[model samples]
Structures are given as structure tokens and as C-alpha cells.
Target: MPQWSEQTLASFERKAKETKVAVMVTGSIEAHGDHLPLGCDLILPTFLAERIAQKTKALVLPPIPFGESWPMDVFKGTVSLRAGTLLMVYHDVMKAVFRHGFRFILALNGHGLNTPLLRQAAEEATEGTDGTVIIVDWWSDLAKSVRAQVLESPEGHAGEDETSEVLAVRPDLVDMKVAKGARVRTAFRVVSASHREELLPRGVYGEPEGATAEKGKAIMKKAEEELLLLVEQLEQGKLPITEK
Candidate 1:
């Protein structure tokens, strides 16, 4: 395993020199309805990180288990962080990794709200340096083709896609009997604390009843392939790959 915590000092130094790439995964403890656990965000990214590290030999940092969960804070089991706080944490972690001589930092974020902050943090951390930061919101950024094929319902918080992922990674934690879905209010971008509930009455955005572990596995497999390709591109100094 390419995990950071499990490595000895000498081993870490050697491996870090060889890879020059560090991956930090971020997630949140928030309400994912009654069927999914509060740690769904944390679990999914961590699962992907482990898979990526195993294949690419990239150093996987210990996951940041908190995120900006303001919209969902009205619900129980939701742990929210001030935007500034999460930003600083990400910036500091990237800075620390850079200090260790790793120039390529990959941030794998599981929560949707953390995307912008993660990008800002990366920008601030790598400014005026040779360091490169790659921010990936795994669910939305990777495996587009697979998602279109595997998911029938539109993507939403605690929806079909997420539910299937949970079932694939930790079936024991999912309560399929209580699984349900709700449509989000996209009429207007109303900013309110109650927006989460108003938009998703059931705390879910898509049909979880349609989720299957098989679909989750397919999604993850495709995501893993995409992630590994990105890392390979980084290794070959061919990063920032853009298509026309």
C-alpha cells in the first residue's frame, strides 16, 4: 500500500523521492438520508484513494474527514466547517507536502461543496512555485462515460449513484429498506439554511431504490482507470491534458 501513515521514516523518504506525488483525500461527515451513513463522503473518496495508491504507488495521505457542509447542517449528524477553516487546512497540508520535496499534489475531494475551496487552496499553496496541484472531485470529474451507462437517475446528494457506491464499498452500512429519493429545487438559486430540506425533502436528490452494488462497482472501476491515467500523465510530465 502507498499509504503515508503506515510508512517508516526511511521508507517514506525513499518512496517520496521515487514518486514525487502526494494524494490527499477530503470528505465530510454529513447527513446522507436515513439509508446512508453520515460518513458517506469520507468513505467514498477514501475507497478511491486506496485504489489509486495501490495501482500508481502514489503516497496517500490520511483523509481530511471534515468539509464545508453548511447547507446540510440543519440535519442531524452533519458536521460543518467554516469555508476559511477548510481552505487553510488544505493550503497548509499542501504546503507541508511541498516541503517534503513532492511537487505534484493531488486533492481528491468527495464532497461537492468542497470543490471551489479545494481549487483555491491549491492555487494559494502552489503560487510562484514549481509545484503542480491537481484537484479532482471524483464523483463528478471522473468516469463520465461509466456514470451515463450505469446510473438511470439524475445525480443528487445521497441519490442513486452515491447509494450504489456505498453498497459497493460497505454493504453492511447501507439500509436498503429505508432507501428513497427526492427531486431537487432548481428553479432558482435560493440561498437559505433550509434549502437542503426544501430542495430535497427526503435528504436525497436521486432515486436510491434504483441503485445496485453492481452499478457501484462499475462506476468505481471506471473512475479508478481514469485516475490512474491522470497519475500516469503527471508522471510523464504530460499533465493538464486538455481536449479540443
Candidate 2:
């Protein structure tokens, strides 16, 4: 299958007549934990995008590796773009894809902080173009299924779900020995707070211990299944597009 992008002129022309549903995966260069790599967010969605493309025969766009990472700004290697800038980036990408004749666009996002921003971007993209934008936060989409399969406390930055996923994808990157202890943060609304350091002193939340590669594999598998169903629904015009 062809990867989606306006840059690929030949492939775009070849798939021009085919169903024009493009999948763009977005992630970030941020700290996962002591055990997981900084690019964990990027890798997970990229992995999912590949699986989704294979299942739906949709063109996969290059994953965006930078996102809004203000909470993890203290951590080394955490790179973040402003939320406004990130939204503009998505808008431009969507416009380009729509210009290439794609009527359906999926924003397969991996980062948690980018959720609200992407939501806004997707709405804007849809309004600005004739193409439909479907936003999918893999973890959020399959959270219930993941919780049913993984027995660990699923609450950290590099917590159970994330660690398990990384272990499943790239075991060599995880330091099992360092993946100990739990860092629980007091729950507070970000809307009322100006200082993030007070809430997350260690740049993490939840328990990191109990993560396993098996659990990650199970979570990923469930995610793929859900995505396939979603794609089918979208193709059949069953998925509802709501405005915010």
C-alpha cells in the first residue's frame, strides 16, 4: 500500500481513484520514564498507524514526532511545540491532504497532552475542507478493553500500559530494574492552575511496576481491532462527526 502524503506525487496519482482515506499519526518526543524511551509516544502510534493501514488499505502519512509537552518540560529530551503552532501544523497537513483528493482523514494521535489540541484541529480541518477528519486517541479508544486484559495499576506517565506497550514493541529499550515504585500525584484541574511543578514534581504519575510485554501485546491487539471496526464504520457512513 502507498503511504499518504502530498509529497508522494506518483503514489497520490496512483491512489487518486482508490478510496481516499488518509491516516496521519501524531506523537511526541517526550519522557516516558526511566525505563521507556523518549520516543515511546511516537513509536506506539506509528505502530498502530501501520496496522491500521494494513487492515483498511488506507495510506499512512509520516508520523508527527513533536507535540505539546509542557508538563514534561523539566525532563531531558522532551520537546514540545506550542499548542497553537501544533494546531496550525495539523490544519496545513489536512489542507494538503484534502487538496490531493482525500475525502476522509484520520488523526491517529498518541500523546495525551495533544488530545484537546488535536480535537480542535480536527474540527477546524473539517470546517475548512470538504474532507472528514476522524480523531483517534489509541489508548482512550481501547481503554476499556486494555483494562480488562492488563491487570496492572494503569496510572503512570511511564506506567503499566505504556511500559507494557514499549516492552511489547521494543523490549531492549525497557530497563525492568529501573521500572519500580509508584509516583502518585494529587489530582487537580489544570484549568485553575498556573504551576504544573506543584502537581507533578517528578514529571510522572501512577504506578510503573507490574507492566509486562504480554499485557502490551494484548492492549495493542485490542486497539487494532477497535480501529478496524471504526474504519469500517466510517467507510459505511455510520460514524457520526460532531462539532465542538
RMSD vs true structure, all candidates: 1.3, 3.1
**What is the per-residue lDDT of model 1 for residues 1-244, given as tens digits with 9 covering 90 to 100?**
9899999999998898778678999999998988999999999989989987788878999999999988888888889999999999999999999989887988999998999999998888889878998989998999899999989989888999999999999999999999978876676677886556776665677889999999999999898888888888777767776799
User: What value of lDDT does candidate 1 attain over all alpha carbons?
Assistant: 0.89
Instruction: Please give the lDDT score at residue 84 for candidate 2.
Output: 90
Q: Could you say which candidate leads in TM-score?
A: 1
TM-score of 1: 0.96
lDDT of 2 at 187: 60
- Predicted candidate 2 versus true structure: per-residue lDDT over 74-187, tens digit per residue: 777889999999989988898888887878887888888888887787787778567788888877666565666575675557788788888888898889897755564456
Maximum-lDDT candidate: 1
> All models: lDDT?
0.89, 0.77
Off by over 4 Å in 1: 194-196
> Model 2, poorest ten-residue lDDT window?
191-200
The ten-residue window of minimal lDDT in model 1 covers 194-203
